[model samples]
Target: MTTFYAGLLSPCALACAVALALTGTAHADDNADKNTHTLTPVVVTATMQDSPLIVVTDPKQPRQPVPASDGADFLKSIPGFSTIRKGGSNGDPLLRGMSGSRLNILVDGGMIAGGCPSRMDPPTAYIAPQLYDRVTLIKGPETVLYGPGNSAGVVLFDRNFERYTQPTLSGDASLLFGSAGRSDQNLDLRAGDSTGYIGISTNHTHSQDYKDGDGNRVHSQYDRWNADATIGWTPSDQTRIELTVGKGNGDAAYAFSRMDGVQFLRESTALKWTQEHLTTHWEKLEVQAYTNYADHVMDNYTLRTPDPASMMPMAMAADVDRRTSGGRATGTWRWGDALELQAGVDGSVSVHTHRAGGPPGSMMGYYKDQPRMRDARMQDIGIFAETRWSFAQSQRLVTGVRVDRVQTRGYTLEDMAGMEHMESMSGVDAMAMMPAQTAADRGDTLPSGFVRYESDLSRSPTTFYAGMGHVERFPDYWELFGQHVEGTLDSFRALQPERTTQWDIGMQYHGDRVKAWVSAYAGVVNDFILMHYPMTSMGVDYASNVQARIAGGEAGANYDFTSHWKADVTVSYAWGENLTENRPLPQMPPFEARWGLTYEATQWSIGALWRLATAQHRVADDEGNIVGQDLGPSAGFGVFSFNGAYRIDRRFTLSAGIDNLFNKTYAEHVNAAAASLAGYVNTTRVNEPGRTLWIKLDAKL
Candidate 1:
């Protein structure tokens, strides 16, 4: 072991490390089923990169260090995913090397749009992982059953309140306490008779600012809560209908932005119906409708005292809201023993509004001067078809296609502070970039599709596959309307749609005592949308189109030795470049790997994990996403951690862990620099949390 490793092993020096995603180390008894037990290491069931890629798993299980606090935090456990951290919670997710609208996310098959133009609340921010029954990640632009604008990938969070054969009652709950005033509580209760049922799920989390390995406060504090209820009617064994309602609220302080979110309120409602076995050929049918709304408030004085010596020396606040509604219908068909098909049509419409004002000794008077303004509205309609063909017992082929029509309307605020800040320009066509006086509208048609082939090894428990896919995405509201340059051009009017063509391949193997998988992908993008960091123009980044190529892969392996010992390893890497500019793609994460070891017994388990990253010398300064631009280069780092658990009974389990065993101060490459306390322009990315300890209890009945 190197000096660093040696130090990490020492109890006194165990100080730093946290991406919150530790190794899914195996700590199972001889007969523990990987899927049912939350205490065992999480298994990564891989598929070909081109396989319309879907990885489905129970989101309620405990894995790695512990359960995630939010959707973005939960994604870190998956391959080819990372987060743009703002604090302990509410990090924005990044897939491959893409951010923003590139990653389309849906909750219970519904779109929940964030109100912040700066992404203070990403789609995932509203998520409480433990409340969802299942989490699925579909990589690449392979399939488009979901609404348009997902050139990078799609994420789905769902809960299936299954009916009961007879009268039944069940529920699960968990409680957690950790360092730095960390605490969490979650509960899920369900009951149903053959005819109907009602259920509810709720969760809460709170934490204070945590210190870095060097004992420096990171300026991150947050508290949040979410609650949801569902009612279902089972007309017959083959038919069902359900209605769901949910509400969430929270407040958070961030070191990265000038202001903090004083309020994040969310509301959602959905109704769905399903029918099964209509005919031998038609296996099932499903219909769904939903509405989601988000209201947010950001202020310099509410979460933290405003620095009188800094920019906007006076207190300021902004309130923004977004409303979205959509519906979908899908049918599943089976043809003989050789084919199965699913076809669906879905659509969504969204509208945004904003208001802002400042400085009054009396807080009640500030809002009187702020006027709410309508900004943007968008609607999309899509139809999709997917099928699987089985030519042989061991071979299969999967294919899918989709087309989407989208329309966008904008009411550009001409008298806004940013618009009036710098209206003059020396270069570029300015007038052509401006929108219509009152409102503007644009429309486009997009198409996406994918195909894949898979075959099982004739002699082993193994599978391999290869596939190709193409996707065209329309410009999103942020890409087109949020990014504006001084006198040069309105990026919204200048930015072009993005088109991507890609190939993916990979393999998976399972043995008596070992399991492994590998996946890789490469793609070429035409008019790739790129966002440059904020410059002299204002606080907003500039979006432009450029030709680009991207490649990446992820691999993992696990082995069990005897009944008491097990080991696992995983690695992920991503690469990209702007072919038009001949420069490395900005905001790419460095090559990373993780190793873990565990010991287990009938009632107790212990484990350790070491996370490692390669130095990223790759640089493309002043260019990146809305959250951050690449800041030259960052050094590699490794952090160690330890965990243990005890099962009290079939209904209860207790676990605890020490993260960043050797509090080694480190920062990720994909991060935004946080502002300092003195109101100074601190562009240095915030350091991750240092050594921390936590304990949790899981119970069910």
Candidate 2:
């Protein structure tokens, strides 16, 4: 596999060759207390607002235009997030204007189901946000304790394992170098006592093929790797148990596809349990279980070459897989400080499969020697409850409820030749045959909820909130077996089940040099699940149900006007409509903004950023929602960047940046379009990238 991803670009020399092949260790600590600690001067733009529509980021610090090998480029550094660009990495993430499964992404809370069907791997493309350590976002659809349609909200990439105070060892590492021949590496380690602990992490990234600002080029290249492990026990001090495992793989190169993804592969495992103060109001109890899998492959011969005017001109390949499994349990209660509670039950299930191979040239392992077939299967089960009530003296109220039972099953008509070879291995143009069915079960019973109210103003450090939510989504799996319905023989028993109902309001502020926030929302969906696409290329691809309307907002701030100067700002907006065809709304995303400045010095820092965006002429252009669509009206731009950091102590730190510092050639309006590759330069969507530079280094122990 390219020499194991080119030796993972030296993750501290593979963690010192796995610590000298296990145990022939070396130790040396205490270099004057690790240089008297002092760090935290990088994170170019992540407006941090941890309340009022929450957003908490910190994936091991280090941000700025790069650093984010995935998880949709670390959620586009936050501000109502946006992505759909399918080039440099897997892209696909949009919140506010909502996208796929109404945005609920969890990792560590388990759920990784992406087996193409034209999504080309999403679920944050198998995540790898610096091997996760915290990233929470909750906006809109308030909360129902994760899972089950988020109505454009919910994101968690958590990981926190503590309890090990006596015999210990810690770790961290990083390296990067960017701009076209980008590179990355990371490492993390841990060891323990206090009854247990063990952790490990690994990462790698690669890039090449980037050019834009009219300097053409653009077939985007990529490479990736990951490794993970965790084990915990902590036998006392309130009990605990944990386990985790992971694996990852990658390949990418797509100028908006026509095949190329050459496999993604991933596998995961999880288990957890906890008990804390277990009585006095039954104060805590939890449990979890999980499994995740994704195995994808796409090909037009590794990474392109076969466009001799499209339509299967040569070799081909397709392979898909999904597994997914789930479990959850929760309990917590309290009353002393007024109130608190949480109750839970959760579930999941998935199973999809596919297979296909070549047209000539034996295509290497020919779809790994074919034979997968299984079509579909999905599942969900739920029960939840949440609460918090601090009645007066600063007021508070928060609530939640959930109930679910969703299902889907398909595969008969003898699998219709594996769904016509999985829609002729996705280069589209083929899919209209399957009219003798009997094997497409479906079911539903969803219900979600939310409610909120809070106040803490007495004299202002500000905090005020308002909320309301409702969800009822269940039709995923690419809106039921990936598109094409009109004379349906089962777009999985004919789509349905969308239903959102939202309203959210916000406010938050924390003083001493200022911090601020604002949020807003509005919703009403009712069966909204659109997707249509097929103005030619053999025409076909549909899926319906309408009546929509959505609203958006996001705002941010940070000030510090001088203690080394600082400033920040943010804004975001989204709007949608299709009130059953009244128009406007199809990949909506426009009106964005950002600005920042910084100087700080205690260990050095410097920063700047700009980024505007605003031309999106609202047009349903072939609609959208399942990875992408609506590639029409769009044009707006602005870009600037800068960065610097140093903290060459506390075990090291160094950062750098310069992304599109001026070579702007924008393009992003719900991207993905630009396919006519055979030497690249097809542009319509896929542009952004030019004037880049990077550097990074970090270490700790």
Candidate 3:
């Protein structure tokens, strides 16, 4: 470990020295450039709209959002994005009241599956935020061309090659230090000319156990590293091709879980082609292809001592590996004065294999004894089109439609252990029945459509829009396999697909000193997939189809005062009910509000934020028996944080902040508790981290 740390730091230190030397010589040039031009606001890809630095389109963005400590941490900043927090890093994302397979998460256009049936190494855990250029999120069922049945939405964390018209070389380096002995270092390098470009990025981060609000040392330590490179070629004015490859690995310990995360690794590759034509009616065309591979392993006795009575005692281990390959082709056409259209077709195929077993204490022993659970394959294909038309100067219409086809197959193995367990329990010398091996297949076709009308207020700086959409979603993997059920193999016996009809309305107001936006939506679902658990046989849970209705809205505003002081506030609320039972739906996020105040100057800025949540009492009567059940109404709480940043020069800057100012302890309603253990029974909701302080230094050349 010491040698690895030294190797990573040595190059960074040398690069920093070189950057400092160059900064001294480049100061005059930078000063003249800065004096002649103004800086452009940094825009995020989460929404199509452009916003200023301090404004967040997603309601979930907060300074420290429960001490993220990883990629999942940074993602929760978006509105409607939550996580199944189980202490520290590697939390699973839950978006817009949906979770697990319902949400499609991609890193650099690659899909990585986790190893743990409990989802310890969520896909997001393999991603290194510092390596990506942009993180884009599409909420709800608005866009399905990106991947398979993304009922919740799509999250694209991407890194793009630098575009240049002339020969150029650039790079940036950063170092971060924080409480709990946390440290991180990153480097980004790019070199390009008129005809091509090449780039590379790498980062490493580590942290020790952190103390929570109650001054207890939480067993949450992690170490991670990543490196990737890309090359692009542009042979002509309107044609370009790019290729990329990357790899990453890490290990971490969970404070709330009984076992430590032993090993995580990922490899990915992608190719993209873009072309623009001047003679044809089609203005542009884009095509992309990519393949991703993930290998993961988890053990009970790797990082910590294992409990004797635990299921995974004596170094029990499990492994899961998955591969995904897919591509898409898109085209845009312009017709007449007020009409334009864009169309695309995309698809992907993924296969996963899981293996477990081993000798009592040997690494290979676990694999020798355990039989394979199942091998699964999934494929999806979709075609989509969108059009924009201008009815008048102040009014416009946007419409889109998509059709998708999905197929899934799983091969089951003979249950040798199941027969043995049954014979042992019977207590009589009886012959074990042989179960036949079988294969299950499922296929479905779904359609989605949306239409919207937008207009600018007659005489004010206000824009308002109303939209309606219908989306049909295929049931996801978790709903199919995670839940316990019989005869699921029969297509007719499977849970029905979820269909949603929804309406959305929103308004935006932009002024010289104030900016505000509000949006509301209502959705009705036919055959919504709901998980139910029974208390029989030591507790069992399963998913079933049910009719449901859901409605929600979000509002946010920011105001600037006296050039240095500013205030911002945002709020969100959601409600859901099962129509058949006439009761509240499960796992609904409570109403919440966030307020912020900040002061700024040319070289420095400071800010503070306050977060508040309303107590929730609404819960489905049959929702608490599942693994992640809503434990009834939850109490509300408030938290505060402070942040600051300073620019030492054009080439250098520093940022620092303290999160959870008061170290208040609280739990989110959607979080899941760790699985029960023999000696450590943790049935309560997952607890959040305590206060943390951090400082970061950044430099560019």
Give the whole-model CA lDDT for all candidates, comma-separated: 0.78, 0.80, 0.69
Give the C-alpha miss distance for residue 319 in model 1, angstroms.
Answer: 0.5
Better of 1 and 2 by lDDT: 2
Better candidate number, 2 or 3, judged by lDDT: 2
Better of 1 and 2 by TM-score: 1
In candidate 2, residue 400 scores what lDDT?
92
Q: Pick the candidate with the highest lDDT.
A: 2
lDDT of 1 by residue, 485-604 (tens): 221234445667899998988888878898888888999999998877755655655678899999998887778898788888888899999998899989999998888888887777
By descending lDDT, how would the candidates be arranged?
2, 1, 3
Q: Model 2: clashing residue pairs?
A: 484-542
Which is superior by lDDT, 1 or 3?
Answer: 1
Candidates' TM-scores? 0.89, 0.33, 0.88
- lDDT score, candidate 3: 0.69
Estimate the TM-score for candidate 2.
0.33
Tens digits of per-residue lDDT for model 2 on 484-556? Answer: 4443444556678988998888888889998888888888888888888878878887788888888889888
